[model samples]
Target: ERPNNSRFSSCSVGNISAVLDAVRDGRKRDCLKEDAGAFCGNKIVEVGEECDCG
Candidate 1:
């Protein structure tokens, strides 16, 4: 059950590969932590990516 004042929801990934594999297969998650391999997002950006409209 969810409380009326609650402002968020949650879920779980049955398998680690579920999330990783989805990202590899071109699916984007709600959020991603910044790292050296990726500066802005999990998706690798190419030329002109800076001007992308979200």
Candidate 2:
């Protein structure tokens, strides 16, 4: 479960899911995942990424 950060304090469940999905896919959108939580960093095929939620 994600902490109630100010960034997502006002987001709905669906919205949060969408953000998580984008991060999981290593996309550069949604909350600037690449900036801090870039486990995959657009390299989805690479292993060990697991998740990215920044």
> What local lDDT score does residue 24 receive in model 1, on the 0 to 100 scale?
76
Clashing pairs in 1: none
- For TM-score, the strongest prediction is 2
lDDT of 2 by residue, 1-54 (tens): 346544544457778788789887887455753555435546454446565433
Displacement of the residue 48 alpha carbon in candidate 1, Å: 38
Tell me the TM-score of each prediction against the true structure.
0.28, 0.32
Model 2 residue-pair collision total: 0
Clash-forming residue pairs, model 2: none
* Model 1 C-alpha lDDT per residue in residues 1-54, reported as the tens digit of each score: 337545433444345557778877878665456653434453556564764322
Return the TM-score for candidate 2, rounded to 2 decimals.
Answer: 0.32
Best of the candidates, lDDT: 2
Worst 10 residues of 2 by lDDT: 37-46
